[model samples]
Target: MHQDFPESRLQQLLPELIAFRRDLHAHPETAFQERRTAAKIAEWLGRLPGMTLRTGVAETGIVATLAADKPGPCLAFRTDMDALPMEDRCGQPHASTHPGVAHACGHDGHVACLLGAATLMAAEPERLAGPVRFLFQPAEEGGGGARVMIEQGALEDPRPVAIFGLHGWPSLPAGTVGLRSGPVMASTDNIDLTVHGRGAHAAYPNRGVDPIVAAAHIVTALQTVVSRHRDPLEPAVVTIGSFHAGTARNIIPDTAELHGTLRTLSEKQRRASRAAIRQVVEQTAAAFGARAELQLEEGYPVNVNDPGIKAYVERVAVEQLGRERVVDGIPVSMGGEDFAYYVQQVPGCFWRLGVAPADGSPGVESLHNACFDFNDEAIGTGVRVHCGVAWSWTRKGQLC
Candidate 1:
């Protein structure tokens, strides 16, 4: 293992990094409204010598670059900055101050880890064979922040040869890293459907078309797209999260609205499932003598880790933390991640950093839960992994 940043140095920085993570948790911001969060990050990066800061990219994103003396490929490390729009019930001293907004997904810890890496790299810029770009991105929670950052030229200006990112995984024990080669996270697409029918009096049965009945049928039939239409081996989800129809119990409403999400692991499945959903909704509604309108909003793409980049990350991780600490072939998740956008543009790898309690405690709160908080114990490991990857990737003659 190449110890560019010694364990003692990383241990000394852990307290400050934990404090920063807590501060971010306390003052959580969501989506593009991360002005204060970006400011705090900018202030921290500003103090590091030889770091170039660019704020306000894609509304609330920030990119800090540290260039090496010799020329080599630029490698990018990304961290998300937005919090989820949910209440924080952790009851920690640094619990979220913002109402209905919290860092329940451990993005706060991600930012702190990247910042720690930046601090170490900035202190010894000569070790870098090329430039290292630290991307503090906003709006990872359903806002597609990664796409916006790319559109705003965050990847340009000495474009990076590859990108790397990580998310906290509660299922894995702390200090372990989970690496996968492809389709680690699924693609997310939204479904908005409206069934139109003629209103009728409750007392009269045959007077008008019933949209409520049609909507019920539509929901039930949509499941077939996942179970019967797609291959059983393939993973897919069609969930109707919201359904609204009649305001009063006495009358049949003229229209009913249905809102749901679609998740698929492969593009072939995604496209096929979408077509099947539209067909099912329309044909089922037609069978009920009702007209249906379906709208599909494309969300993030499937987050695929480049095979070579994944191998590179795995090597660095195994070197930094022992082979036992580095886990391979973690199960794929149905959850969506905007990091898919970055990988689509450049060869990138997004791995999982374990945040579960190291002491083997049960009942660790899962992500997006009201009481979920990032494990502070994982800070040192995360920082070490990020720094190790950056250092090794930026070394001369390194290829990812």
Candidate 2:
């Protein structure tokens, strides 16, 4: 590894980094609506010499490839650029400028981190042997931005042998890197259950089929998919996140809908649990004299790691960010991510970059919360970690 380059350079670029992030944070964009954000990023990336810019591959997504004079394997580093529909409560100077649209998911910080890496690669061109692909993806907040990019040929051409991406987590310290070898995140799928019941007057006790009653049954029984059908050792979660029933208590509504997500770390569990839920919802609703309409939407897949690439990430985190802050083999999370789509196509590893409070005064605020913001100080460290991994993975000779 090259030791002459210093992290001090990151401080010099901080003014622009912080400004870019805040400006984008203020004018937050939702999935597929990141035209301004995409333009801003493309403008910044274009300033860097020797990098070929490619935009509009997947609906406002931007990809820039940096090639070295010498040839080696290609490695891609990705960052999701999108905002959630939460309000900004961080109260920081760079707080969300948009109303009702906030960067509560720490995506703003992820973009800054990848940009930091790009600056470093630009500075130390001679040291990098293989090519580095910088992916500033859009629609990561909820839309399937990652899926679109891959489908549009981001991973093709050089066809990166290994891809690496990271999520900003608030559970760990500001500069800590949380890594796992396999099944790091759970698969997420959304199913909406609409129960068709006959509407009738509330005064008549036996006039109509009570959809509220049927919905209660469906909700309660779906939980059994995890407790009864799945193994105890294996991780599984089926949560009914939303339910909309009768509009007025006096009148029994004809239709009631139940919406929720199913999370699992294993593919077998995902398939089995989903099938079980469908059957249970249909059967349970049918018994109550109501027909069921179910719509299951596919979401992020399980974030699994490549054994070879995962080992390299550990080494990079320790050397760049320090060993004390680099955690290994943390328990997997139930949250789903579209990054799984990319991992499915190639050998890759997805890890969490922790940015939570260490003193316990202001502890972690789970992602998608309005108060969440990525620790800006950690941006430089993120760059070092990515470069270190790229070098280790694509270098001709390194720790094996």
Candidate 3:
């Protein structure tokens, strides 16, 4: 840890932080509809003196800025404030109060950690050499909130030289942090395909071209994009999650619609997979005596971490939590993150903070699971790491 980190003050503040996290978890919101969540965050940050608060940015997003008497380069930390549309099966008292909405992805804990950092930093303004911006982003679950916030100038007017963010990982034990250099997450693309064919009665043998048959062939052929078209070493996924066809068995439907997602780690691979999919769908449909239409909806790009920033974060984590708790060169994940948008505009690093059970126990639930909850024991560790990085950067300057 940096010599200036106030360990005693952090211990004193941990209880309130945990309670705040639980409260957010109990009353969860999803996507751009985080009005209550934003209000709660704003209320908490408003208590601290000398903090500039901006509300309603990008609709249900908030940005809080804190500066010191001394002048230096500004740094930013972002926390997502959206929940998933799933049931809360954790069975805890602080579990979700809303039906079909839960904080299963740990965004609540993220908000608490950022708030804790802001509180501690606010108390010791003399220690800061520059301003620190806290971004409360909304709609990270497929809503593209980060892109909208950037368009509205969340990164401007004392723009940060570098930004940082973190997500809770259940695979690692508490107090440990995972760091990787490049391509930490994959790019996401939504695919919608419609196979068109002639409709006819069941008794008529040659009256109609059955699109269901063509759609089935298309689904089977799409796998070839990943298995044969792309290199075996490269990672890619082509899943047809939804398939809809005729309502009754006796009638041949005119069309069949298929919806799915495509994931790739590199832009080159993304392009190759897309082309392969289109070719397979078109040719397969033509062979079945039917026509098809394909549409691709682009999503978040691959999240690439800045090498220098990753190194800086690793150094800070090792100092604060010891070398044993810091895991370097963790494998890249196929999951997607909107934080990728922020890094495209400025140098940034997004890492994983361990959140599994502190005790050595079995049956740890993975993220996005209904029973998964953010472990409170990891909040202090996250706060310490975030504060360490922000303080070290503001005082010592950029590493790269």
Select the stronger candidate by lDDT from 2 and 3: 3
Top candidate when judged by TM-score against the true structure: 1
Compute the lDDT of residue 306 as modeled in candidate 3.
Answer: 91
State TM-scores per candidate. 0.97, 0.95, 0.96
For model 2, what is the error of residue 118's alpha carbon versus the real structure, in angstroms, after optimal superposition?
0.6
**Per-residue lDDT over 1-400 for candidate 2, one digit per residue giving the tens place of the 0 to 100 score:** 2364465787788777877777777788888888998898888889887788899978899988987344877888899888988798877887877788988888888888888788878777666667888888988766888999998999977778788999888778777888888898888898888999999988883899988889999999988998898888889989998889887778988989889988999988889998999899999999999999998887888888988788888887787767888899887888878888889988888888877765555755778888776777667667778877765554653542
Q: In terms of TM-score, which candidate is stronger, 1 or 2?
A: 1
lDDT of 3 by residue, 1-400 (tens): 5566798999999999999999999999999999999999999999998799899988999988997334787888999999999999988999999999999999999999999999998997766668888999999999999999899889987888889999999998889999999899999999999999999887783799999999999999999999999988889999999999998889999999999999999989999998898999999999999999999899999999999889999998988889999999998998899999999999889999999877868544799999988999899999999888876674567432
User: Model 3 compared with the native: what TM-score?
Assistant: 0.96
**Candidate 3, poorest ten consecutive residues by summed lDDT:** 391-400
Q: Candidate 2: which stretches are off by over 4 Å?
A: 68-70, 358-364, 394-397
lDDT of each: 0.91, 0.82, 0.91
Clashing residue pairs for model 1: none
